[model samples]
Target: MNIPSDLKYTKSHEWIRVEGNVGTAGITDFAQQELGDIVFVEAPAQGSAVAAGAPMGSVESVKAVSEINAPASGTVSAVNADLTDHPELLNADPYGKGWILKITFANTGELSGLMDAAAYAAYVAESAH
Candidate 1:
């Protein structure tokens, strides 16, 4: 579980990297490993509103289809179109080329409630037990 110190995490497995007023969102490494061999991804259209904890997109793997929820609220600014054609990138690089969406946050203050690397690592560990 590689949780970067710079990002905040959601209990649902989404990670948010806030840069200025924009945020890059993706599934955590633990999430990708669990999903297994991602085959497809469905992302929200640009400029669409996304509410915190709500479904932002979906990821389909050999095991099952899982919804990728919003880690925070915002208007979706961009989606990684590469995933539509090469979904395996998610399994190969869950934190990099696999990033799902970029959003312009509705309220930066809401970031205070998100988990840090330590907390998210603990959450992952506890869930495994």
Candidate 2:
């Protein structure tokens, strides 16, 4: 439940931190918690093109495997290589060291479609029942 106010959130439980035209994407703290103990992360290759809402990677947990979607259309500039060997970081610090990918987005305007921290918190709360 560590929803940082500055980040944008997708309904699927991904968060994006945009800086200039580059966006850092990751599963939300709520997502990591729901997935349980993360055992593996399969990230898209660097330079890959991903569309908004498309699966860019996947995370495997002790309980189940879940797809990680892109929050906006972009060319993936980097992948969090550290997660391949240390998937537990997703559970340890999802918002910081556990961030999954960085993309050079085609349009910053698409960001308006995402939720802010307050809206996302309410969305998560409503989904709980």
Candidate 3:
């Protein structure tokens, strides 16, 4: 499980990297591993409003289809168009080029509700057992 220490995580398996009021989000390494061989991504459009914990889009894999949730409330500023062509990037590098959405969040305070890397790791471990 390549859980980066700098990102915040949701129980649903989304991770967010906050920079000022902007956040970039994607499914964690654990999620991609479980989903298996991502084939398609339905990304939210730019300027779309998404609420924290709400489904913004979906990812299709050889194993299953999984909803991608918003980790914070915000207007989506960008979507990774690259995923449309190369969904494998998600499994290959989820934290970097595989980011699904960039959001300009309304309240940075909402981030405190998300789990830090340590807590998320524990959560994943606990869920596994």
lDDT leader: 3
lDDT of 1 by residue, 1-129 (tens): 678888899999999899999999999999999999999899999999999989978999988999999998999999999999999998888889999999899999998999999999999999989
- Which should have the higher lDDT, number 2 or number 3? 3
Candidate numbers, best lDDT first, in rank order:
3, 2, 1
Q: In model 3, how large is the Cα lDDT of residue 109?
A: 93
Candidate 2: clashing pairs of residues: none
Model 2: per-residue lDDT, tens digit, 1-129?
689999999999999999999999999999999999999999889998999998888999998999988999989999998998899999999999999999999999999999999999999999999
Each candidate structure's TM-score, on Cα atoms with residue i matched to residue i, is: 0.97, 0.98, 0.98
- Over 4 Å off in model 3, which ranges? none
- For TM-score, candidate 1 versus 3, the one ahead is 3
Query: What is the model-wide C-alpha lDDT for candidate 1?
Result: 0.92
User: What are the per-model numbers of colliding residue pairs?
Assistant: 0, 0, 0
TM-score of candidate 3 versus the correct structure, residues matched by position: 0.98
In order, the Cα lDDT scores of the candidates are: 0.92, 0.94, 0.95
> Model 2, residue 2: what's the lDDT?
89
12, model 2: CA deviation in Å?
A: 0.5
